[model samples]
Target chain A: MNSRREFLKLAMAGSTAAVAAPAAASAQAKPKRWGMLVDLRKCIGCQACTVACTIENDVPEGQHRTAVPVYELDGPNGPSQAVLPRLCNHCDEPPCIPVCPVNATFKTEEGAVVVDAEQCVACGYCVQACPYEARFINHKTGVADKCTFCVHRTSVGLLPACVETCVGNARVFGDLNDPESEIRKLMAQHETKGLRPEFKTGPNVYYIGLDDRLASTVAVGGGARDLRQGLETSAHGEV
Target chain B: MPAVDLMSFDHEAVWRPWAVAYFLLVGTGAGAALLLAYARLVRIAEAKGALIVAASFALASGLPLLADLHQPARFMHFYLGSAPGSIMWWGSWFLPLFIVSTLLLAFMTGRRGNAPMCGGERMLTMIVGALALCILGYTAGEMSVVAARPVWNTLGFPVVLILTALMSGAGATMIIDSLNGEKGEGRYMLVVTGAATLVAFGLWMLTDTNLSTLAADYAPVGLFGGFIIAGVVVPVVLAVSAKASLLLRGVSGALAVFGALAFRWSTFNGAQLMSKTETAFYGHEAALSQDALRTLAGSAGLLILSLIFVTLLINLLAVRASKQTQA
Candidate 1:
C-alpha cells in the first residue's frame, strides 16, 4: 500500500512537472508573463467590453464571445453585489488547447489561447474539455472561440476591448512579466484571486473582490446552473 | 424571460446545450448499433433492414455535431489522431468502426442467398455488440467526467446509457422486422423491455436519492409519456396478450421507434432545463447567447445543403446499383 501510494504520488508529480515544465521553460526564455487583471470594485457591468468584443471580432449572435459572471452578493446592509467579468482564464495549463483534435486551437508565445478560424472544424470537443466554459463555436466563422485577450489588438499594442472600454477603469491589460506593468503592480499590491484555482487550470485572468462562496461554487461544479440551461434549450429547440 | 446581459459568463448554461446534443447523438448511435447487432444474433430475416436503419441513424446523428462545431470542416482532425485519453476523441474512433460493421452486416444480409459467412458473421456480430456497448459506456463516461454537474458525475450514467442503447436498438429492430412481414420477434422484445425497465429503475433510483440528479430525471417523463406508453407499453401489452399477430408486432415495433427517438430527445432537453433553472439566479440568459445562435444558424445552413447533396448522390447511386443488380 505504501509503495502504491508512493508510485501514485510520483506519477501525479511527474505529470504535473511535465505540464508545468513547458510553461516554466517558456516563461524563463521570454521572462514575461502575459495576463489580464480585473478590478471588481471598479467595474459597473456596463457591458461595453462585451459589446466591443462582439463588434471587433464579428462574433455571432446567440453565442458569447466573452462572459462576465455577475454575482449579487449580500452586502453589509442591503442586497448589494458586484459583477465579475470572466473570459478564457487563459490558463497557464489550458485544458482546451491540447484537447483540440486538429490543433485548431492553440496557445501563442505570449500565453494566449488562439483559435485559427480557418483551421477550426467546429467540433465542440475543446468546448467540452474546457473547465471554464470559456470556449464557444462561433456560428458565422464555424470556429471555436473565446477571449483571445484581443490577440489582434495586442499585436499592434492596443488593449483588449474589455480593458479599452472599461468606464470605471476596472479591467487592466498588461504583460505580467514586467514588474512595472499595471497588472503586475496590481498583483503585487493586492490580494487578488483566480476563479477555480483548485482545478489548477492556472488561469491567467485574475479577479479582485470575488467572494469566497462564489469562488467555491464555481470551483466545485463549474457553474452548474449555466450547464443546466444549455442542456435544456438544446433538447427542445435547435442547439 | 428577461434578457440577461449576453456578456455574463454562467458556466452551467454555456456547457449544458452542447452536452445534451453530445449525449443525444451518442445515445442514438449506440442504441441503433446495438439493436442491429441483436437482430443479427437472433438471425432475424430482416436483420439487414435493421442494420441499414442503424447506420442511417448513426450517420444522421452526426449532423447536430457539425452544427456544434465552430469549424465544421475541421471535424476531420478528430479522425487524424488516436487520442485514447479523451472519451470524445476515442468516441470518434468508434464511428468508422460502426460504419464498417453496419455496412458489412447490410451487405451480407441484403441479398437473398448470401448471408454473412456463418461462424464469421456471428463473431463479427459479437465484436460489434461489444464495441457498441463500449461506445454507450463512453457516452456515459463523457458526461460523468464533468464533475461539476453532480448529477452527471456518477457510475449509473454509463450503465443507463448501455442498457438504454440495447433497449432502443432491440426495440427498433423488432418493429422493422414486423414491418418487413417477419413475425415472432417476441424474445428480442422481452429482452429489450426487461433491459429498459431495469435502466429506467436505475435512473429513477439515482434521481430519488440525489438532489443533483435532476439533470437526468427530467428525461423519463418524456420517455414514459411520449415514448414508453405510446411506443413500448401499449404495443408490448397487446403483443403479450396475443402471440404471433403481425398487427400487434407492427404496433409494438412502431412504438419502440417512437419511444427510442423520444427518449433521446427528452434526455437531451431535460439536462438543459436542469442546467438553466439551476443557474438562472446567476443572471445569465437561458436562451442561446449571441455567438452560439449565430453558430447554430450557420451550421444549420451548411448541414441542410450537405444533406441535400448527400441524399441526391445516394439516391442516384442506389438507382444505378439496383439496375446493375437486376441486369
Candidate 2:
C-alpha cells in the first residue's frame, strides 16, 4: 500500500515536469524552422499526397490544401510527364499576411503559417494576395483556410499525413533548422529550386528536377514575343 | 522550355458584385458630396437641390457596405479590434466620419435660403469636402495596395479614381442644375473634370502595361467611345454652342454619369478575370444568383428611398422655418 502511494506521487511529479520542460525550453530555444522537399523524379503522378492531405485536414470537396499539377513537356526524346506538387510555400515574405485587414492569418513561432478562424473576417483579400494560389475560403467554416503543414501533428512530433502516406517517399518533411535532419541533408546534397524564385518570397517548399515551363510563371525582363513563347496551353484544365 | 498544359484550380473570389456595388456607390456618393460642398462654399444658386441629392447618396452608401459583410452584427469589431497596418481599418474610421459630417452639413443648410450662411456651416461644409476626397482616395488605395493583382498595384489607381469621382460629381451637379433651371459654374466644372479624366487615363496607360492591354481588350469599346463622344465631345460642344438648350446639356450630363458608372464596373469586374497564376486566364462569369440579384436591387432601393426621404425632410424644414418667421 505504501509503495502504491509512492508510485502515484512520483507519477504526478514526473507528469508535471514533462509539461513544464517544454514551456521552459521554448523560451530559450530558437523556434524550429519547418519546411518540405519534394523529389519530382520519384513522384509517380498518383496524387496520394493530395488525397491524404484532404482527408487529414477535412478539406472541403472541390477545395484542396495541396495539389499535384502534372505538366507534359515535349522533350527532345518524346513527351515527358513531370508532376509538380504545389502547396502553400510558407514564404518568409508572405504577401498574404500583410494585406489581411484583421491579421487573422499569421506565421507561427514554429514557422508554420496558420489561420485563426475566430478572427477571420472572410474578406478574401488573402486569397487574392497569395502568389502561389495556396489559399481558399472554407465554405463550411465561412473563413479562409489553407495548408498549415499539419502543425497539429508537427507540434507533437509526428509526420504530416501526406509525408506519412506518400506512396513513392517523394515528400520529405523535417526541421530545416536541424543540421542532421533529412531535409537539411537532402538540401545540402542536391540543387533544389523553389517555384517562382523571381518573386523572391523565400518559399520554404523546395523542388528537385522542376520543369522550366513551370518555373516561367513569374517571367521578368522578357519582351512581348519572349513572354508569349512558353504559355501554358491548358488554361481551361482543372487545377 | 517547351510549351506545357498546366491545370490550375479556380480560387474563391471573396469580393463579389455586392462589393463592386459598394465601391461604385461610395465613390459616387463621395464625389457628389464634394460637388455639393463646393457649390455651397461658392454660394452657387443650385447648391440647395444638389445638397439634397448628395446628402441622400452619402447616407445610402453605408447600405451596400454593411450588406457586403458576412457578419453585419459584428461590424463593431472593426472599430473595437482593428489592425493598425491595414488600410481597411482606416477606411472603417474615414467612411463613417465622412457620412456623419456630410449629414450635419446638409441639415444645417436645409432651411432653404432662409438659413443665413453661418461660419459654423461653412466650416462643416469644408470638413465634409475634405472627408469626401479622402474617402474617394482611400477606396482606390484599398485596391491598389494589393500586390497580388498587378492591375491594381500602381500609384495611378488612386489618381484615376479621384478624377473619375470629379467627373461623376460634376455630372451630377450639371444634371441637378439643368433640371432646376439654375445653371451656375456647372459647365466649367464639367469641362475641367473631363480634361482631368483624360489625363488620368493617359497616366494609367503609362503605369500598367499588362492592365492597359487587358483594359483595352475587355473595357467596352462602345461605352468608352460613347463616354468620350457623349460625355466629353458633346458636353464641350454644348458648352460652347451658340444656342445651348437645357435638353442638350441634360443629355450630356446623363452620358457622363453613365460613363462614370461604366468605368467602375469594368475596372472592378475586369481585374478579377485576369489570371494571377501563369497558367491561363481565369474565366469569371458574373454571379447571377437569385440572392445576388435581390441584394443588388435592395441596395438600389435603399438609395432611392433615402433620396425621397431627404427631399421630403428638406421641404418640411423649409416650411417650418417660414411658419416660425411668419408667427
DockQ of each: 0.15, 0.25
**Candidate 2 residue pairs in backbone clash:** A239-B8, A239-B9
Docking class of 2: acceptable
Report the C-alpha displacement of residue B243, candidate 1, in angstroms.
Answer: 3.9
TM-score, candidate 2, is 0.85
Candidate 1 lDDT over B1-327, as tens digits, reads: 222222344332333344444444445446656665666666654354345445554554565665555455667777775556667777677766765675554444433233234776667667767777777766677666754344455665455555555555555545555666675333354455644655564565556443223333444455556655765566557556546776766666556555544554544434433332123333333235664466446534643463344334444555665677677
Q: lDDT tens digits, residues A1-239, model 1?
A: 01123234545676588677876576456455578888888888877888888888888775666756554445568556457676788889887765555667778888898887776666665775665667766657656778888889777656677677778778877777766566787788999998876678888988887766555443222233436555443233222
Summarize candidate 2's per-residue lDDT along A105-201 as a digit string, tens digits: 8999867889988888777778878878888888788778999988897776567778877888788887777665678888898989898776778
User: CA lDDT, every prediction?
Assistant: 0.58, 0.70
Error of 1 at A24 (Å): 19
The segments of candidate 2 whose C-alpha lies over 4 angstroms from its true place after superposition are A1-28, A216-239, B42-46, B111-113, B184-186, B216-244, B286-296
Candidate 2 lDDT over B1-327, as tens digits, reads 444544445555566667767776677667777777777777544476557656776788887787666555666767767676777778888889987887777667666438577888888878988888789877888888877677778776677667666666666656666777766345666677777777777777777776565555555442256445655556656655513577666666666666665566556656666556552444534435565578668877987897777777777777887888888
Per-prediction RMSD in angstroms? 10.7, 7.0
The number of the candidate with the highest TM-score is 2
